[model samples]
Target: MRPGDIKILLVDDEASILQFLELGLRNEGYQVMTASDGLTAVNLVREFHHHIAILDVMMPGMDGFEVCSMIKKMAHTSVIMLTARDEIDDRVKGLKLGADDYVVKPFSFQELLARIEARLRNQFPHLLNEVTIGPFRINDQRKEILFNDSMLSLSNTEYDLLRYLVINHGIVLSKSKILDEVWGYDFGGQENVVEVYVSTLRDKLEDDDHVLIRTIRGAGYRIDLP
Candidate 1:
């Protein structure tokens, strides 16, 4: 999707930072929405399906971590936490709660823009919009997956994971690599989440005697083309 086609939510208690990000992103042709606090951000998220959310971690009432968790559950939006706190624990905590990336405050607009672009590129790779592997057919543009022409209901995370696997079909992806690529720069290094999602996909995509995703022992997982 083009940058102009992407919708982004900018949340920060500080009006200056919020306006800065909104203006910068809009200059790049992106559709931008601004919120002064986490609670407002959450409400906006529920009202609109934002493609990316840049949240301030220090918001009053609902913090960024809390908002990130809520937004993750609501939509398949990529989240980046922007905060002045440089503590490692806070970064890890945000990632664990499903923030796709974290940025320290006092950051340059160029750097922030680069990070936003990187996140979008990673989440929505520029490749074939549609792909087919084994019995599954995937429409990356629409975020839809089908097994033998039968549609499979998937959450945002499930669709992202499945899309990544299908894009790299026949290649073994290590847990760490998958986490970095699919979950963004930080995921609290929760490798088990990958396992859980993979299990869920197999149960939905696999038949009695057939499995689309396979474990490679100590390595990670692969979705081999059948």
Candidate 2:
């Protein structure tokens, strides 16, 4: 999907950050949603499906990790955790808990935008090709994915991962392969990142009858074709 075609949910207790991000994203041509807390964010997820979410790790009610877990249980939503904590452990924990990416606080919005765009590009490279796999119909050119004739809202990372699996249906793609293919060389050997994305995708896509993507246990993942 095009960056402008993507819708993002921005969750933070800081009203200033929410306003800043919303304005920035909107100026970049993206549809943006804002929530001040985890409860509101979860409610928004249930109400309006968004392509991706930017969640603050520190909040009053529910923290980012809790919010991410909730989102993972819901749909194949891509989540990027924002935190002031720059510890490696914090980063690892977030990824292990199912976040697609991590951005440190005081980060450059330009970098965030770049990451979002890269994720989207990897997912919808064709951006205009109409293809179907099981109950899903994807129009790459149109930047749309439909499940049973209903539009499926996917985050930039989710869209890219799903599209990659669809394009390489029936092939076992190891975590390393997926990291390289989807995130490119700049991902710098982050294998855990691949696992997080795969887990998120499974949660979102497996709800339907056809299970197109499957885990290979100790190996990696594959797109199942019947």
Please write out the lDDT profile of model 2 over residues 120-154, one tens digit for every residue: 54443443246666667877666678767888678
All candidates' TM-scores?
0.59, 0.58
RMSD of 1: 10.8
What would you estimate as the lDDT of candidate 1? 0.83
Write candidate 1's Cα lDDT for 1-226 as tens digits.
Answer: 4676788999999988888788889998899999998888888987777888999998779998999999999998899899898999999999999998888978998988877765775565543355555677877788899888999999999998987887677789999998998899856767899989988888887633435688899999887775
Task: Give me the candidate number with maximum TM-score.
Answer: 1
TM-score of 1: 0.59
TM-score of 2: 0.58
Pairs of colliding residues, candidate 2: 51-155, 123-160, 127-140, 127-141, 128-140, 128-141, 129-141
